[model samples]
Target: MPIGKLYGIGVGPGDPELLTVKAARLIDETDIIFAPQSKSGKPSVALNIVQDYVDKRDIPCEIYQPLFPMTEDKEELQRSWDEATDVLYEKLEQGKSAVFVTLGDPTVFSTFSYISSRLQNKGVEVELVPGITSFTACAARAGVQLTEQDDIMVVVPQVSEKLTKILPYVDTVVAMKTSRHLDVLEDCINQDPRQKDIVSVQNCTMDDENIVHGFVDNKKYFSTSIIKFRK
Candidate 1:
């Protein structure tokens, strides 16, 4: 039996066409595909991105729906991950090649990192393919440069409370996961000394995408706010 291998494939932002040739090929060729589901039992965005390439007739598909409203409880998170890994481990033990699809880039703020790490520590063969990130997609959709001249760019998750201090130094700031902190973010950027213009993009590169400028209402989730200081 061939030693089972794991593929951490990035399906890009939202557009199915944004799938890399390698990603598309893997989805087509891999014997098994694993997609993570957020609670509510909905299909994962990651899976949706590469659904067209997947041959439902020939391959075994596993939908591992994660417990909804991911909590800060370490014990609970660990328990859930262990259970999820068991499912993958069973496939690997059978020498089944399994591919886990992730949205945007696999490396940036992806839960795949934790899963891959646990698998590798147990001696599973693993490979990663890069995908388009929300920052780049949002920036392009907004038609703004991430950085220019001698200015620096900072990418931060919306969880950080340090946005106040960081605002003074960077030329551009991309704040991800802004849904939880939308109010704080709006107040911070609007009050910046540079008076940075803001662009908020949700589900970038996908149909039904939402983009807005200036003093946005605090409802949209899965968003990135771009603050451009280069006037």
Candidate 2:
């Protein structure tokens, strides 16, 4: 039997309507779907975004929620990837195509990157379908332009001291995963004299979405901040 292929689909930032046409079609046609969850027994956000499409599939698609723990430990992360790869490999070898759905663009800070690399090393063909990123969606929701002509932009996954160094060179900064380090981000913004505007968007495009004009005091896991600086 011929080995099946794997597709890494980015479902977009918390909006079902944002799913790309290709991604939706692939999810509908794939033999199985793998959605990653940070904790055991918890529903997957990526799955939730595309659940409607999954339900509309003509043939029932098998769904698997793989645990990809949110941790900084490299060893622990690698172990989880190894396990997920094993499961995917077995299905692929049986000629069953699979789709792995991610919260945002699969290439941007997604667990699919690790799994796709491992699958590629094991000789499994993999394809990636890009989706609207959280930062872009947040920028739209906040009504902020990320950059203009001759302007530089930088996207920081986690705000830190490095953001301070980056601020001097870039015209715009998109800070993702800001819930954990809002204090550090606030300090960086405060010290920057050229800071023009800042907006924090929580749960972009979701029903409970919120937009703050300045720095956000509260923590929200899905928060993204768009910061602009004068030239």
By TM-score, the best candidate is 2
Candidate 2 residue runs with Cα over 4 Å from true position = none
Pairs with steric clashes in candidate 1: none
lDDT of 1 by residue, 66-137 (tens): 542356788877877777688888888888888888888889988888889999988999999898888898
Cα-based lDDT at residue 55, candidate 2:
92
Quick one: best lDDT, which candidate? 2
For all candidates in order, the CA lDDT equals: 0.79, 0.91
TM-score of each: 0.90, 0.97
* Residue 38, model 2: Cα distance from true site in angstroms: 1.0
TM-score of 1: 0.90
lDDT of 2 by residue, 1-231 (tens): 988999999999998999999999999899999999999989999999999999999899889998999899999999999999999999999999999999989999988999999999999999999999999999888789898888999999877667777678889888888888888888887888873788999999999999998878776789888889876
